[model samples]
Target: MVLYFLALVFGLHIVMVNLGIAFSTVIPILKRKGEKENNEIYLRTSKQLMNFYAATYGLAGVFGTAFTVFLLSFYPSFIGLAGHLTFIPFGIAILAIVVHFFAITAYWYSWDKWKSDTHFLIGMILLISVYLIPLGFRAISAFLNLPQGLELTPKPHLDVVAALLNPTFLPLYLKSVTAALAAGFFTISSAYMLKYGKGDKEAIKIVEKFMPLATIAFTIAIVLGIIYAETLNLFVNYKFENAFGFLIAAKAKYDFSWLFIIKLAMFALQTIAIVSYLKIRKAWRFSKYIVAAGPASLIAIFAGEMLNSFSQYPYFVAKLADKEFVSSIPQPIRDYLAERLNLELSNPLATSMGLYTLTLVFLVPLLISAVIFLYILLFGKERSEALD
Candidate 1:
């Protein structure tokens, strides 16, 4: 259950972050074009979209902080403490939440009146700063794990700050940013199809203009993702050992033919989505296909990340001490379960959260299907008209 929750949280974070970047970059560019062309509808829609993106950014930060705290609670030793610790990363999380609130306030109240140039600059700075804060915390957390074990002390000859500053960090950051941009572009493309595409030639023209931007953003994201993976391989080889090492060893034993096939399939789907957007100029038929393709690629990326995390599992902190620390069932909990119920310590993962698994398997898909059906029923005409 915890793993599933974590995956969902991380997936949402990736989507929202990318969407925020997409709106931040693409909106301004489009707004400038709208103004030059004296296109009021385009200007209005762009501003509204920008405001929505800014608001969603705050929501994402709030959820992100909650997820971070949940993760910390699950493995407190990751920060060098048995329980909560006043680490620099935690401090940054708090600061990010505060900044996100301010950004949301600025976006909400400035709807009618144009913000002063100074205020707008400040708002932009705050938004960008908040966006990067989580990345910084993640990098720090990963670095602090280099020593491994239950203690917070820095490992011999290993500096957490120095590890945080390694060459790999910059590439990772860029990769994440580009990924966010791709997500944003994909989302905006969907929105354009939903809200504007139809027999409305003007709306189709606007969407057509945006399609190339989305395609370029997605292309950059994929390229950067590949580069980032290479850097990660180097990091694992030069600085680490353990299950991750085991997994790397396993990967090395086999040619990545299957992985390459998956990558190619993802790339082809994304390319098809872009082409559909360029040619269709409508939302009715191919919008869901595009949406699914974008997220499918994202899921593949998540699967790769999961493999890395699994390599580091059981040991919350790695290579920090002479011996690795593994989590144990608390004696009290174990005793209670033993006396009052039949418990299997050897296979906890299978039985730990039966209810959650059931809910995910049955409820989530049903809900999505119902929603999609409702959308089609209500908006089918609009979609058809847009396409016509």
Candidate 2:
């Protein structure tokens, strides 16, 4: 129950933070190009989207807090070890977020400050920092999963570079960055589609570019994921004798191969669909297909996360505290944490409870988003021209 709750919060955090980061990220890119091309459309759209970026950034902080609370409360021992082991990356990430917050704030308000390049530079810095932020997290998460980082002791010492560069760090970082980019660009396209409908040319262009880009990004993610899976397989094969035959996990007791297959099919179909749509972009049905890109990519993202989660099974990170066959220490470690941190929820989600909880969790956001959409529609608070 606790893990499920945390997963929900973290997933929402992922979506929201990715939205904010991607929107702000595209701003500088578009602004740089807009200035170069003398294009008003790019500059105007970037400014308009900044409004929503501010909102997403604020909401993400809320979910981020929830995620931290759940992590500390539910998985104290694991996170305790994690915090000590990857302290440097985690520390840097905090500083980065602080700077990122201030940078985005400055960029938002100084749009007409007669320092266009400087403002864009601020956004570029924010963009780079936002990109690095996830890498820090993935470093810790990957370490936790693979137990690949320096094993902490009563008196632990971390080698900053080595800790930040855990065995699973690069693959996980690339995979997540690709995922964020896909989500990020699609989000931009999504905002336009929902606001202006598919007929808007700028919206159409964004939709078109993001579609193929998402397909490419997702494809790269798949490749990186495959490499990560092979690494996991090697560990399993060594520990459990040919589970993946050194190519897949030999721990086949519960297989999510089907989920992986479905995810692959979705991406392949998305690519094919986007390519077909682009080729005959004038077709009357083009709008619908372009619109479909957003949902397909989102579903792909969900599927990938689900498959990864199930594949790891009992461990938050595989083998960290796993107590199956030859693994049995995770539960004991949790017990060591005392009452507040020690929680054992045996899939406490009854079917009815599951349905009810999921409905409420999803509906609240849907309603809030609907209200925001309507507010933007009514206000028509469009962008002003560049500072002259």
Candidate 3:
């Protein structure tokens, strides 16, 4: 239950956060070019994306914080040790988040105030920071898996440097880059499809330009993911006999190739949807295929996550150590959940509270926001007037 909830919230949050990074970087470039070319499409698209990013940014924060709280609450004991060792990475992440807030706020609000070069420079740093933010996160996650630093157990304490240098850190970070780019570009492309899916040539052109990049990034993401998994298989003690089993015969144990196959198949269809439209421009001028890419990308991402998590079952952080830590949950709660829900529980108490927070805070706002978004979509001018 905990793993599923974490996956649900964490996966959604990761997509939105990376999308914010992607569009934030693109908006300034598009703004500059739009000014030079006197292209209303570029200008309007940037503005719309800015509004979308601003709105979703708040939701991302909510989910991200919720994710952290659940982690701490569920694995209080294990994370206490892990957190002490991993605090440096978390510290770096928090500092980055602070800078990110101010940078993005300035970028978003100072559009009318700042000069072009100055604003673009800020946007560049903002992109750098956005990309840098994930490094700390993935590093910490990697440490949890490999935990080489924990083994160091320095005289004073754990070596922060060694912890950050976990074997899987670089590979996972590289893998995450693919997800960030693919998600980000897909977000931009989908937004274009939504706002101007009504036979707008400029909008279609923008979609054409961005969708291809999204497809390509997703392809690279798959390749990087394979490399990362192979690195993990080599490094981590707990092996997935089922992962890459069909392709890599030596690794085969059972019929666990199904998820891997489906994840690839979904992305393949997505690529075909994007490419087919690119080749046949006239017939697909306003094709649903363009909009269809949104769902396809999301499904692919979710499926990939499911496959990754499923391959490593029954262990929260498995590594070669004197002592191995299993799932982080009370035994009674874990047993109850297993018997009743046929699911594993990480932190039942945290899950209960987190669900409340998710419902009241995130879910309610989502409902209200959905209605408001529909109003904006259906009647932007009128809604803008009423809000004003």
Candidate 4:
């Protein structure tokens, strides 16, 4: 249950953070197109995307903090050890986030106040900064799967350059960025589809414009995902082996392969839905399919992330030695920690029922309410105006 709660927080953080990434990725292009063509819809969408990113930024911070706290409380040893090994990447991500926030603020506030090109440059800065975030964090994630940069024995040490250049890092980063693009465009398409249902003819145009982009991005994500999985297979093949065995739950043991299939299915559905909507040109009859795209993309993203995490069960780091992947943590140390800390060495407060109850009752509701508030602000009849 505790691990599930932690996963929930991490998942929320991933969604919100990716939303920011997706918005940042598209906003500048939209702004530039709007400027070049003098299209009101494009400009309006760029502004609206900025607004959505701003709204989710706070929620992302909240979830990120909650995730960090959960890690600190429950997985102190893991945090302590992992933090030491991956501090460089973490620092890079943190720095990028700070710069990204500032760039977003400047881009949002100086919209018409600055020259068109000047303002677009600010948006570009925002885009670059935002993208750099995933670059650093994904390296850390890849490192966990293949701890290539660090020596585990004779006093642990990390080679920063080697860590950043891990085998799985590039594909994972590309997959995440492309997923962000798909999710962002699909989400925008869904929003416009809703307005189109409410008799806004203009909204359909917006949907038409974004749906194709979403499909393209999703296609790239799918390809990159395959590349990522093959890279992971180089380290861990068990995740791909017997991938569909979960369908026969009665006879099969649990495995993370089901997640991979579900993610692919969702992605396929989203792509087909987008293509069909583009071909049909009837937003009303296909409203369900159009709106479902957003949630489908999100589900696919979540499943992909969880598959990566769950596939490495029972160990935090997998170091390659003599052409085989094995736990980076030595067996003797694991045994000592288990014996001394009762098999919960990674989670010091594993038995803290009171703290768990407090978090579930208080912290969880607060986070949920914040999300509700954001939904109201973003989708309500009275939408928030751009800061400028």
Candidate 5:
């Protein structure tokens, strides 16, 4: 039950951040294109995306904090150890987020007040800052998967460079970039599709522009994801085997393979929906395919995230073999952790109370915010009344 809630919050955070990063990547380029070409439609699209990003940013921060709190609450020892070793990466992510927030504010508020070039510069700053966040966060994820730079002897120590540049990190980061692009473009396409359905002829142009980009990104994401899985296989073979069965003549044990298979199925469905939309975009009778494409892409992304985490189940940091995995963590530190760490639920009462409180505090607000964002994206006027 707790794991479900954790997954829920984490999924929400991932979606929010992914979409935000996607917008960050394209918004500046769109703005520049608009300026150079003097196209009102491109400028309007950029502004709309900026508004969408602003709408989701709050929800992203909330979900991220909730995820952190859940980790601290449910898995204190793991969180503590990870933080102690990878605090620099955490610091980097936090600083990047702060800078990103300020840059976005400056960009949004100074829209027409500032010169076009100056505004574009701020947008670029926003893009760089947003990208840095995942760079820092993914380092910890890479370390969790492979613990590449840690000297877990008398006390745990981290080699910041090695940890940041772990083999797993680059693949995962690239996958994220591709996924973000796919999600962002598809989302924008979907939103404009809604507008096009509402008889806004100009909106079809946006859909036409974004759909191809979305499809290309989605294809790249799938390839990058396969590469990422191969990278994981090098370190955590069991999890990989459970996921893909791609190891030397070994079949995937049906542990978490089913989840991955379902994710793939979702991916296939999204591809079909996208292809169908591309083929019959002018046919009103087949409009449902266009509508299905967005949710299909989102579900596939969520399923991939679910498969990634759940496949590594029954272990905080997955390993190949006990003896092999423990080689990096010296006996003293192992003994210390063994003595102090209680991996199981230590206080059910506290856990229950925490869950209840967080559901009320975080979950309610998240739902409300999501509804507001959807409304703004789908139906709100050009000038958002909520923002103005």
Candidate 6:
């Protein structure tokens, strides 16, 4: 369950960041183009896109806050050391939500007011905030987990700001930003194909130009991520290898072989996707394959992150009496509980409510149906033609 939740959280985080960056970049680029007709069309489409982006960011922020609060509830001890840093990220998230709201409002009112530059400035400010807030939140989270931190329990050793300013942090931040940009590129490509397809020559041209940029961004992000991970010594002292080694303990059953395999597969798929995107003009029909590959690659990456997060479950709250918290509990007590109740003490991180578990499940589907019906009623056959 922890693995699943981590995977979901990681996937949503990547998607949200990508959407924010893609819309922010694409809107401005479209505006800057000298083609008046194309620009006008893009402006109208961008308003809708911006609304979607804002909703996505808002959802991500809400989920992030819930997840953080959940973590706080489970591991009350970490509150003293990590809670403040957690709130730091939450604060950024709030700022992002507020900025997005203002931006969307300004956009709605600016259609007739474009002559005044104030609306444009407001839009640009919102875009900047969208990019910066998420980046700041991610940076703060990464900083808090660095090795040079004050031990949460009793010892105060390292300076918080200094820890945040570490050499490794900046590289990681850059890598994260680039990854988000790459995700954004893929998203933009998908949107262009879905909306414009073969009919819109200008849109095709724009997408064609953007594809290479996305590819370049993704490549650089991967390279930088590798370097940053190495710099952090993520594999130092055999931390990964030992925990996931072939030589498992006597009672332990599953190894991390599946995780390694999944990671390798993800890497191979991303490589193929990149190659396919580069040759898109030659194999235009195969563009959908490349598009599909993008999301698949993200899923694979999410799986790998889940494995890493799960492996560190025992150490979720570090510097406690137990090097590994699960192992520290008395064996007989564990055994008796397991035997009598068929329950074993697992990682607290293993708490996730599946999508179907939500309370307004029926209402959600009903609402969606009603919205579709209303759209059909209002637009008649024109909606179908437009969609096609």
Instruction: Enumerate residue pairs that collide in model 3.
Output: none
TM-score of 4: 0.88
User: lDDT at 161 for candidate 4?
Assistant: 85
Q: For candidate 2, lDDT tens digit of each residue in 244-308?
A: 32235444655666766667676775666557656755642344444555666666666666665
TM-scores, each model vs. reference = 0.65, 0.77, 0.79, 0.88, 0.89, 0.69
Model 5 gets an lDDT of: 0.76
lDDT of 5 by residue, 224-328 (tens): 998998898877776677666542345554366667777777677768758776686575322555656676677767777777776655555555234566665
When summed lDDT is taken over every stretch of 10 residues in candidate 1, the lowest stretch is 337-346
TM-score attained by model 3: 0.79
Rank by TM-score (best first): 5, 4, 3, 2, 6, 1
Q: Which digits, one per residue and each the tens of the lDDT, describe model 1 over residues 1-388?
A: 5555555656456555556656666555555566678887667666666656653565566446545754554433332332233255556656776775666566545644664454455456555755666565556545434422222234223344665665555565676666566656665565555554344445445456656776887788778766755654555433233323443554332233344455457667778888776666554343555655546556545544444344343333322221212123344533432332211122233334664566467647744664564365336565343222
Clashes of each: 13, 7, 0, 0, 0, 0
* lDDT scores in order: 0.52, 0.62, 0.66, 0.75, 0.76, 0.53
Q: Positional deviation of 253 in candidate 4, in angstroms?
A: 7.1
Estimate, for each residue in 1-388, the C-alpha lDDT of model 3 and write its tens digit. Answer: 5665566667667766767767767777777788889987787777666666666677778778767766665655555555556677887888888888787788888875889788878777677777778888887768656665653213214566887677778878877777767766776676557656654566766776677788788778878887788777777634345555665564543335677787677677677666766675655455566566666666666666566555555444535221333244346544432332222435566667656566457656754775586467435775444322
Model 4, 51-168: lDDT tens digits are 7777668888988898888877777777777776788899899999899989988987797899988998888899899889998899898887676787756766678888878888
Flag regions of model 2 displaced more than 4 Å. 152-154, 190-198, 236-251, 256-262, 281-285, 321-388
Q: Choose 2 or 6, whichever is better by TM-score.
A: 2
Q: Candidate 6: list runs displaced more than 4 Å.
A: 6-10, 34-45, 84-97, 108-116, 147-158, 195-202, 234-264, 282-286, 304-308, 317-388
Instruction: Give Cα distance to truth, residue 292, candidate 5, Å.
Output: 2.0
In model 6, pairs of residues that clash are none
